[model samples]
Target chain A: MEITDIGGVLCNGIKEGKYGLGLVRVRGSIAGVFTQNKIRAAPVIVCEENIRDGVVEGVIVNSGNANAYTGEQGMRDAREMCRIAANLLGCEERRVAVASTGVIGRKLDMEWIRKKAPEVYSGLGNSVENAERFGRAIVTTDRFVKKAYSEKARIAAVAKGAGMIAPNMATMLCFAFTSAKFDSGELYDMLRRAADKTFNRLTVDGDTSTNDTVLLISTGKERVERDVFEEELCSVFYSIAKQMARDGEGATKVFEVRVDGARNDEDANLIARAVASSLLVKTAIFGCDPNWGRIIAAAGYSGADVDERITLSLSDGRDEVFLIDSGRPLGNEERARVLMEKAEELVIRLRLEKGNGKGFAIGCDLTYDYVKLNAEYTT
Target chain B: MEITDIGGVLCNGIKEGKYGLGLVRVRGSIAGVFTQNKIRAAPVIVCEENIRDGVVEGVIVNSGNANAYTGEQGMRDAREMCRIAANLLGCEERRVAVASTGVIGRKLDMEWIRKKAPEVYSGLGNSVENAERFGRAIVTTDRFVKKAYSEKARIAAVAKGAGMIAPNMATMLCFAFTSAKFDSGELYDMLRRAADKTFNRLTVDGDTSTNDTVLLISTGKERVERDVFEEELCSVFYSIAKQMARDGEGATKVFEVRVDGARNDEDANLIARAVASSLLVKTAIFGCDPNWGRIIAAAGYSGADVDERITLSLSDGRDEVFLIDSGRPLGNEERARVLMEKAEELVIRLRLEKGNGKGFAIGCDLTYDYVKLNAEYTT
Candidate 1:
């Protein structure tokens, strides 16, 4: 497969101190997923339109201003972004996908974007440094830029987002590029499945964003086995999703919950998500308390209807304790406390004595800084 | 009406230092509202049955341990608590309602309860001191015991609860006493409606507890108009609900959200509840930020489909600002900021220009203190 690292793409800032604009070129067909939130941003709308043709040359993305709810002007700005990217790449405007993330309810800085278009275009290069710039350009409130891929397969992706999480449709900007050949329909199906298993299962603050988008672009420059490509893409997406969860707004550490032997996958998922998204659960983890009751309570309210036939366990990779067995407390208070205090990779496991359906969710502990970071000043 | 406060109520600690047991002696009829959570506690089950005949002498309540998820032993303990109260109050066993609120899943200290029953009964007195002791006896983590009453109608109530705030059936313990005459049928009907408008509309932390119960009692010692009784009872219940909302775990301010002019009350309630229960909205209120976007976002995702024809306003009793008008910002940033910073009672008003239906919810802002109070230690 003729795979190339995304080294040299146009990346710049429409606003100073914030990398708010970027364009990455790839010769391929396009497939994508959009936010399930009915109130979508203008860029999400544009991305949907551009990808309809099943052919895309690249993607143009920005942060700092999610062009959503800015009325008709928001639509115009999104279209103009694609137009600019198309001009720079010498492709049809319909071939350039667009995405925007950050502060919602504002119009994009089209005037600044227009003025800096030439500069960003001129800076395109095919180096790892260029690709790293793409990483740096897409962040919003994210402490670190996240990228994942299989070097052997040349499937690389960069993602940006931390809060407003509870992704119904991967609420963030994620762009993946692959040199492997695949039809648009095939790529779309693969992306949709991978995203559901990964991004859709994650939640941070439980505030779904207005602009959640994920795009997979296959250059068709080289052919690869479908199963291998799917596996690699899913791995990369899952990795990025984990990073987003860990970097959740004011997050202290990653917390993973796995519900096993539920009545079904949906019930397992509901149980896992309930525990992961519970503020009480998050705070308990933050406090380093073996408050397994909160976990069980969350599960009880999840509508899973597992009755009292379940076991709850907690660990920090080293210290592990089964806090509840079949709705009964194990009463290993000291060991549970020790496990909770470790603060690294907290794992909550729930085993329902039903059928063997299992599901899991990755999230982060809630912290005071989360409140400070997201809601300190009136905007 | 022969007005009398809840005096001559036997109250004592089931566990030392935690005044967690009580029996109120009132020759009255009782009606109650319970939690909607499918996972109900033993006390709830007992109360449901005991108060079924509409004849009740008093309530036996315990704090420091919520008798929920305690299995068969829990049910027996709750029944035994009622039996003891019935014996002490000189009434049938079924005439005494039971409630326990504190930590869930742990069985009550039955030995302590049985031993202390005689002391509590012996010390009962018809004095304000006795009534206040009843208030002090039924609290879990509450900083203040909440009470509301109308002296003229001889109606009064006491309640206790703090965390696990979201309630399909208000998860706290509320026991109301009245001298005004009303049958169980009428009392039940009135209590149901009043509780729905009051207790059922309050949320904090969004965790519906397994044990939430509210009971209303009448001595049938004097006759009163149904309208007067209903009005006074609703007002008192609403006042108590407001107190609970304000005192939510670690809340700094009471948050009231009103949705008016919706297609129907159900939709209106959906919108109001969505905003009230939102983590972002609560956190924003906590930070005193006039971040109206979070409010609109919450409403947008509330399945309300409110298009661009809605108005969102925020006020703190006096200061007010129309933040959004028909999906457009009013640009009254300073006023909104001023209104938010007051930190006493924050009211978010949403007006949909669709119909005249209206609904409201009372909640509390999410605070770091709430996390500390609810999740500091493992059970």
Candidate 2:
């Protein structure tokens, strides 16, 4: 499941050393950052140091057990993972970043990694098959593998995330390697901006995980301009984010709530996110009620600088629109029919008189399937 | 359903000329205001002007039809109801306040008013039958009548609001007449404060009605200090708010989420409300999962200054404590069992290591019954 539309690549293979997919080892010049949660995994410490110098060669990732909250033993296992990966790849242990995503509060099996790391390294390749395996290896409750690749700057990227997602961070993990050239500082800034527009705009169950991370490594095989790389990387990041939104738990329709004419960009985001996450609005969308009252009511109580006199337009991804002025629906029967007939996407526009500000957010309708999926998830 | 606790002198009668419920029409002085929504109602306009000059004697209330959104014809009907009451009470029409609560967008029939006013005035008396009838007459979708009386102040307050509630100005129509002797200015202040803390704290499906109003009438019978009257009035109002929350559609348990030590009061409220209103947390409560993770996650993403290292505690009331600290559950199995057994009322404590600020919010569990209630509401 590679997003070939984006020019990125992913690879996964088994290791014969102590640091296999299920073992412990941090190897490769791959820089990464962990979620800012206080209860971070030991792998996050290793990943943070590797990125401190603003450069990395590769990443070592494993699943089946997340070495988080395991006390001092967790740290020792993480260090041992780095030693094995570094020795095999002929790189210093400090340059290699490590990441693990699985059940928490468990220590890694270092002996298995020491035996499997060599075989996994030997199998690594820059082919589509490896990319698929990498996507599958990082998954936990995900229904499908998520990977995207783009060729705009001759760059490659891939990611895996599904549930327990919310704003600012997601519960899953992602790793992207690109051939384009860029410094570590530039990559960090670009990743933050892209994430703000992408991962930060999503909410599956509004839960942020303790072991969430994204590691971006530059192979430096191609020397692309800094500006072009940033732009293309942002585009690719947004594309993957859209895919994540589409794959939201039991989601059928992906709704993009775009709020304009707010007091500021932050205000717009606040108002838009409130509407997107409102249960009334989501359920109404599921029932196809076209209940404009719920929509206006959500905006009014969003704690945003909203004036009742703001003009509103509700469109269904088309020319059909319902215009609301001064908190009352305007127009005749033809307009109502048009709004009802249009399908696929619902676009609500709010023009506030306060200031020239805007907000964009992504969401999905709340179907009965969504309730069923989450209610019986563990069972 | 008469709330006999907040005892007030009882009087119920039919008014042909005023349409209905026109038993008590005291004509001397009055003060009143209307909702700011542009969709003006006929009664709102008539009452807005008559209540000026800090004097109102006669009040004409009609049920079965709300004279709202009927344009000029509705305004005329509201004035005519007041005119009949004023003429019968031998007072200036300007001293008469009019109120109409029922279905929206329907014009009132003046012929019914021409015959009902004198009959109602003739039957005015302080009796339990009238008080019960008054409570019953004001209802719309409520399963039972609600009326309250306070024996300490010889003041009684009765309200009618069951559906389409969620308050900014107030929730539905509440006409509370007190016998306490207080100045008009003092009464206005007390009413405003009580309305803010009580009606404003509740949310029923988060829907704000177009015809919500709360009017406090002082009969000037019992002389008391202004401060004492304010306290009594607030207590009475809080009782009404609690009933509304308990009677909320499909709510199984009432929960109070308190977030303390936040950076500011606004941030605390944001986090507390976020956790209280989270569908995931509510559903978990319904399932009795004792899942504190969802509650903390909701606070984290509530756009508040959340320190994940902060302390958290869950209780099945005030005494039976369950999870304390972050993710570590109680080692005592007996304590966990005791907590799980008592699930009538739950409280979640989210302590952030910021400034000394706190917020309190109340909500109910989300169940399949709740979904059924809302999903099939209009249908």
RMSD of each: 3.0, 6.2
Candidate 2, position A194, lDDT: 65
**Shift in Å, residue A73, candidate 1:** 1.3
Q: Write the per-residue lDDT of candidate 1 for residues A10-83, one digit (tens) a residue.
A: 34323357546776777678899877654678888888998998898767887778887777888899999999
Q: Which residue segments of model 1 deviate by more than 4 Å?
A: A1-15, A164-171, A204-207, A317-319, A354-356, B1-16, B151-153, B164-171, B204-207, B354-357
Docking class of 1: acceptable
B65: Cα error in model 1, Å: 0.9
Question: For model 1, what is the alpha-carbon lDDT of residue A144?
Answer: 84
lDDT of 2 by residue, A112-145 (tens): 7777777667766656666665556666556676
- List, residue by residue over B233-266, the lDDT tens digit for candidate 2: 7778777765555554565666678888889988
| Candidate that scores best on DockQ | 1
lDDT of 1 by residue, B12-80 (tens): 333357546776777677888887655678999999999899988767888888777788999999999
By TM-score, the best candidate is 1
By summed lDDT, the worst window of 10 consecutive residues in model 2 chain B runs over B162-171
Q: Supply DockQ values for each candidate.
A: 0.44, 0.17
